[model samples]
Target: MRIAFASGKGGTGKTTVAVNLAVSAVRVGLGTAYVDCDVEEPNGHIYLEPEKDLSLPVAVEVPEIDESLCTVCGECGRICEFNAIAVLGDRVMVFPELCHGCGGCFLVCPVDAMKRSGRLVGRVETGVSKIAPCGEDRTAPGGEGEISFVQGILKVKEAMPLPVIREVKKHIPDRDIVIIDCPPGNSCPMVESVRGADRVILVTEPTPFGLNDLEIALKTVREMDIPVDIIMNRCDPDAELPAGAFDDGGARVIARIPESREIAEINSRGGLASLESPEFARIIDKILEKILRAAREARR
Candidate 1:
């Protein structure tokens, strides 16, 4: 099943949930792949360390203007909704960044002065992790097996993230459980990453800002008609948002990871909390159980 771990804002622990879920899934002998859809800041590889096996460049089409096509009537410029085409007296210029590949400028050009051209957006890298010893399957909750990991990384400074995210998702295995580490914020990139997945796990904290963004993300996912569950990371009893809020809103509360100094230390050291804390690992296993159960029900 394809599951996407996303959040409305940054530092809400989406990647933390995604990586731990992937590691847990792998522990059960489930051939799994983790796609880091956060192309702008892909840190999923930092934990999994998948070997770079394949790299593919992703490109997007933009408008290119032909200067020799006679008069700059401004027709093409006016027709472009993205403001990609501009008329400068007798010359017409096309801004590649502004172009959305809608081809409106090309269609409106009387002399066919506008043409489609490609620009490199980003690249996708595929890598597999070396098999690690089975140290009592911490992800399955009373289960045991060896774990294998795989990850995808997008090239840095890539503005268009959807293309790279789509390419990374293409590597998901049929029988394996797939977890996508989606980019933060409820934008096009986040939408593309979670689209058509079996389920989505929204990770957030217990603060007002977290609740506000969580509401935005909930709306986005509801509009997409996808099922979502909540995981309150760094949960505190005295927090502003209650744990039952998600359940009351018609979504399940899969897990609640309490705030801990040990977790902070492990996070500072760039390590997975589940790897450092066995208690947190159990919580991840419970989350995985919910995911697995949901996947099974969908298939039936």
Candidate 2:
């Protein structure tokens, strides 16, 4: 079963929930793998702290024009939808960054002047993290089990992150459960991260900005025909939602992590909030039960 934790915007404790859920799943004797798909700024490693075992570079194909074989034809430029190539009278320019690596320019070149070249976009790393059971120190020996970890690190200043996110997901182990820590937003990165998830949990605060983005993310996810559940992080009883925010959508609030300074402090110190907080652990356990139940039903 693949469960993805995502948020419409940053700082809603998306990664916090994802990491703890993976650990909690492992504590219950489930083989779990945590994949961080937020390639642009992946920080789940800070919590998992896995000892990496494999590192692979991810590259994308970009057009490399061979001037010697070039007729300076404008066919390549016209075929590129992203304007990655241009013909300037006597010269041809190829902008690798602008290219989507679709190889359209190569197919359109009449003289075969376009050569394929690779640009290093990012890298995928895989490792294992030993996580202790709930209420136990993770650093101590005799931990319950190990959680496989896979994450992507996109090269700085890279415009395209989908390729890196795809690479990270390719490393997902064949575990009983997989938890994806998605990028914060309703953009392509977040969508790509949760594309194949069996269930999606959107974490949001009670603020207006949080709810606003949540509605957008919820609608988008629903359009993709994926099952969605919302986790109200830092819940405030007095907080009010925007009108019709959750009315017709099948998405519902499945859990709420109430406002607590202790939760914040634990997470701030790079500790698993669920490991030390019994209340938090119980919440996670409930969510895990729901996920497992859904997965079993799907299997049936």
Candidate 3:
């Protein structure tokens, strides 16, 4: 099963939930993998800290102008939806950054003046935790664990991130479970990360901003026909359960992380919640149970 964790806004603790769930799953002896498909700002690595095993550039096909054979007919410019290509009387300009790598300019060139070239968008990196050191857990020393990790990192100031996100997802195979740390917001990048997911865990807080954004994210995920669950992070005992809108979505609340100084301190230092807070194990266990149940349903 492939599960994605997403949110409508940033700083909703989406990565925090994804990393912990993946860690908990690995501890349970499942063949699990974690894919940080949030190419724009992948932070799951700050927690997993897996050793690098593979790295590759994720490039897209952009139009390459052949000035010698060019007619400067505006056809290439007309066909480009992203305004990436422009043709003047004697000059052809190509904006690689603006290009979505659709290759429309190459196909629409009447004089065959447009060719294809690779434009580096981002990169995909894979790493191994405990699985690489030991073939099986029993043979390894005590306290050693296993988990696979992958992440997509977009180039600075690059507009197109879908290709990188797709490349990262290609690492995921049919497995017991794969946790995806998706980009926040209801944008194309977030959609790309959430696509093809069996289940999506929406992480949010009790604040008005959190609730409002959660609703927006739900609309997009619901359109994809993917099962969704909610995790109310930073839930304070003194505060009321501000999940009425979430309740209306009809998705189960798998977990609620109470606000505490220990969790805050650990989180500030980029620590894994599942590993740092022993008191939160009960909540993590319940969340893992729901995640496995969703996977089983997907199998059926």
Candidate 4:
């Protein structure tokens, strides 16, 4: 089963929930893998601390124009919606950063001057990590077991992240459970990360800003027909949420992590909250149970 943890915006405890759930899954003796799809800012490795085992470069196809054989007919420029290829005077300029590799330029080239080429955008790193139960030492041998780790690092100034996200997902090990930590927001990168998830957990806070973006995320996931639930991070019981917060197409609030300074401090120190806080551990277990139940229901 593949479970994706995402947020409407950054700093919503999305990665916190994802990594802890993966570790909890491993602690329960399930074959598990943690895939960090936030290529532009992947930080799950900081918590997992997996020993690096492999690194592979990820590249994307871009148009390479051969000016020598070219007739500046402007066909390639006209066909390109992203303006990746343009004819300026007698020369053809190709901006690989803007290219989506849709083959529009190649198909519309009347002189066959456009050729396919690769642009290195990022890399995928795979590693192995071990996790123990909530109370046990992670480095101990008795109950600890290995979990596969995969993350993508996008090169600076890269305009696109879907290519690197796809590359990272391709390395998801066969496991009883896989948790994907997706980039924040409801953009193309977020959509691609949650594409085939059995269940998606949208983490948000009970605030005006958080709920506003959460609505957008809910719509995106519903449009894709994926089963989704909401997790309220730093939830305050006294704060009254807006009326109709759960009305219409909104997802149910399946779990809530209360506001805790300890959790914040632990996370700031690159420690898993579930391993340090008993209350946080219980919340993770409850969330994991709900996720497992949802996955089973989906398969049925």
By TM-score, the best candidate is 2
Q: On TM-score, who's better, 3 or 4?
A: 4
lDDT by residue for model 2 (111-165), tens: 9989889999999999999754433333323334888999999999998999999
In angstroms, give how far residue 13 of model 4 lies from its true place. Answer: 0.4
lDDT order, best first, reads: 2, 4, 3, 1
Model 1 lowest lDDT segment of ten: 141-150
| lDDT by residue (tens digit), candidate 3, 63-114 | 8888899888889989999988877888889988888887777777889988
Query: How many collisions between residues are there in candidate 4?
Result: 0
Off by over 4 Å in 3: 131-144, 237-249, 297-300
What digit string (tens of lDDT, one per residue) describes model 1 on residues 55-155? 77777677777778738889977888877777898798888876656667777879987777888777777767643334553344433333233343444
In candidate 4, where is summed lDDT lowest over 10 consecutive residues? Answer: 134-143
TM of each candidate vs. truth: 0.86, 0.93, 0.90, 0.92
Q: In model 2, where do residues sit more than 4 Å from their true spots?
A: 133-144, 237-243
Per-candidate RMSD, Å: 3.4, 2.9, 3.3, 2.6
lDDT for 31 in candidate 1 is: 69
What TM-score quantifies how close candidate 3 is to the native fold?
0.90
Worst 10 residues of 3 by lDDT: 131-140
